[model samples]
Target: MARDYASRCSLSPVRKTWLAAAAAILLAFQGIGAQKVRVEEELEAYPTESVDLRCQFIDGLGKTKLTQVSWIWEPIDGQRDNIAVYHPIYGQSFPNLSFRDRVVFLQNSLENPSIRISKLRMADAGRYTCEYATYPSGNEQGTTTLTMLAKPKNSAKVVTVQAGSKSVVVAQCEAADGKPAATIKWLGSVGGNHSTTTANGPDGTVTVRSEYRLVPTPADNGRDVVCMVEQRTQEQPWVNTVKLSVEYPPSVVIEGYDNNWYVGRSDAALLCLASANPEPTTVTWTAASGSLPDTVMVDGNKLTVRKVDDAVNTTFICEAKNKHGASKHQITTIVIEALEDPSSAGVVAGAIIGSLLALLLVVALIAVLLTRCRRQQRRGYPSSGDSIATGSGGSNGGDYGNKARLLFSGTSNNGSKNGTGANNNGPIYTYREGCDATGTLTEKANDFHHHHLHHASVGNPPSAHDILLSGDIDEPERRKFDLDDSMEEEEERYDRFGGIPGGGNMLPPAYHVRRGHGGDEEVDVYLDDDMESQRDGSVISRTAIYV
Candidate 1:
């Protein structure tokens, strides 16, 4: 459980859910009272829609007598006294010849007569005064002026873009046959540098565009943008305006030179890029448990660590901040060992080694005791079983030698070789020099016994015993023999010694005996060479290899 806890220590689900919901609510509230309208803050940018203007209060009984209301205009240059007149009372429209068919108003409802002046010319682009005479309680007159200035047919276009990338921005202001083509204005949140111009066409047509771009950030995500279309003859700053909404999302990234490589002292860098539509205000770095270096430096999209040292092993943190909120990154660890000190670990290492050595000694002593006890159990009849114990007699035939004779079960108390042979009628002589080992070998013979003697042709065969590997079985270079091969080989090899046949099953690393194929003759001569000897002629055996 402790391991699992260390594996994950981060934000939980409930906190994350609450934070997200809160952020969404705050953004919605920011937009509630932000919608507004104006005439010409920036004329080059505007939304395309139907034109609607209602002058309802101009006549106090606004909707009544809607049919009686009409319009009139005077021609420019005094070419005629009255350019045109629409009189619902006369049920007639009389137009001066010079201004004939030049104007029409399609709307009624006691609103302002929204007139469309056709074949508009430079002289037509002037103050258009709407004169109203109302019969509401008293006679009253009022006027509102709309200066008809030549304006562009199309507003400057706006383009959407992603944050944290380089880009180019360009827009054109164009119109056909306006008195003087509109001027283009480019506006944004920050430094908006733009070039303006007019490309003249036949008959005073004009094309004007603004050219500019900037690398955007999250802070630039949704900024109110505007472009102005200024007409030369207009008294106001602009004849029309266009509003642009630039939308880009928050972008966070790691950028650097060889960021994943092991960074070095002076030639390395770490770049943390934090950008958002609403615009982040600040960026910072922190250490998990230590102070951040004083030499650290930051730029718009980059955070750099200078002259890193061994102390750089501390965890590093990145933070991005703005007025709305802030975000932090998970701690990332870096280890810096300036130079390895081989001798520094000697003291603690010595203590660990000493403890392990003491443990090994205790384990070895317990293992020895267990081994001796098990061996005694397996050899219940050892005193009568071990025989032909051939060795160079250090003190010939003494009490110890007599004990050896009794252990073989060969000689009787009267110093006669007891016979379990065909010549059991009398005492038997032991084999020439082998008698000292078994107190003597039996002279009672059979062809099978002669075959068994062939195995002992040399001096004395090695004692039937098992040997362990030089060290632990876990050593890679000293791979062990498979249990099955070791056991099978042990049984076959043990038959060469004097161990009797028909013992119960034995595990590997143990000595045992078995009868020959016929199962009638007991093969007492087993040939196990494995011993504690570890001698020059030790034979190696394993399943993974073949000889």
Candidate 2:
């Protein structure tokens, strides 16, 4: 009956207001009990890592004794599902088929009721709530958000696009299996044009590919090209880099020599330098004109000249070779002036002849001087003066005229006089004006006659011209004889009889007469044997007589 009256009775406006106030007070108390369960607002974890959805009872809240712990999952676009539940008497239970073995409840203490999700997946990333039931404080609930991150797999590759074009390639960068769509970018030495594409994977992941078309030059060789992947959850971007290699032909250069080269010297060297990707396998030296000298020696890049000469004045070519190609450089060896000029045979011959002629002239002059010295020695006289006498001589009484005669008698087979004529018995008469130092001239005359006879007894005799020349004297009182008119007659007589005018082969004889110291008295007379033999010998000698 009290329940019927209370159900039929209507309260006034003030009583209704009081009843609403009472209800509000009860709701406020329940809200305070719900606030006692504490949970994190957000939670973050990687895929394959564990995530905890915690719910705890606040201390001093009068809800210390726990009865039940229930966990639920709310997806982004799906219905709420029960994940796990626990009661002290019943242990733990998984209510959702999808999260059955992946969810667990923590029961370290009655005050804390938290659920952990192991090996979290993209599907597990959602809002989770935990509800706690206490005996005296009723039930309290908390919610937490779970975030799962999956890193993208990044790769980079450089592939050759064509043959004979190693310098050109395609640089490709890819990012796969990313939870969210990944952004791919090409950096670091990528040049020219490039393109990007994105794909969705079956496992709710994204894949991004970036292909950069590159035409690399020689300068870009060995450089790095990078591909980077950017994702929302990653702090550092994913990077992939590739290095480039380039090949080319050889570059040839010659060094170690200059224009200051010369012949007959060892002052120059030639060096061959080749710059190539692959080092040159061979180096050679050659001449453009003449053949290479035997003195040239090659040691790697160095070409040494053992001796330089005219043969080296040609174009020298240095050839270098490698796998790529061959290259050559040519240089002309310089030649300088020689130290000695060349002379012709004619000039040399002329010099020799002139030297010989001068030598002959010198020899001839020496011979002439020697002959003069010998003649002076044989004459027993000084070369340039007459001999002085210690005494003076006066004229003698005997006839001593300047007439010389030569008589020759024809000989029979018996080597004796063949005729008994008056000329044969008497001495041939010869007159001279000169007188001996003795008062008589008979001894001087006898001496000259005996010399002539003795020479005639030998084979040779003086001609009539020589007899007449010997008779002439240089004294002021003597007569001068003219030979031009009478030379023919004397020559005729010499040819007819082979002798002088006396008819005997004898040369003109000479005499020397010395005077006595007291007066013009006879001292001595001597015949010269050289005058009897040599037709050119001096014919007169005199000595002074003291007064």
How many clashes in candidate 1? 32
* Per-model TM against the reference: 0.23, 0.42
> Candidate 2 — which residues are off by over 4 angstroms?
1-42, 56-83, 94-103, 108-112, 118-145, 150-167, 170-193, 197-212, 223-243, 278-293, 318-547
Residues 472-545 of candidate 2 have per-residue lDDT tens digits of 33443123333454445444444543445666443223322222232222122223332111122212223111
Using lDDT as the measure, the top candidate is 2
Q: Estimate candidate 2's RMSD in Å.
A: 24.1
Task: Report the Cα RMSD per candidate.
Answer: 29.5, 24.1
Please give the CA lDDT of all the candidate structures.
0.42, 0.60
Residue 138's lDDT in candidate 1? 32
Q: At residue 514, what lDDT does model 2 achieve? A: 27
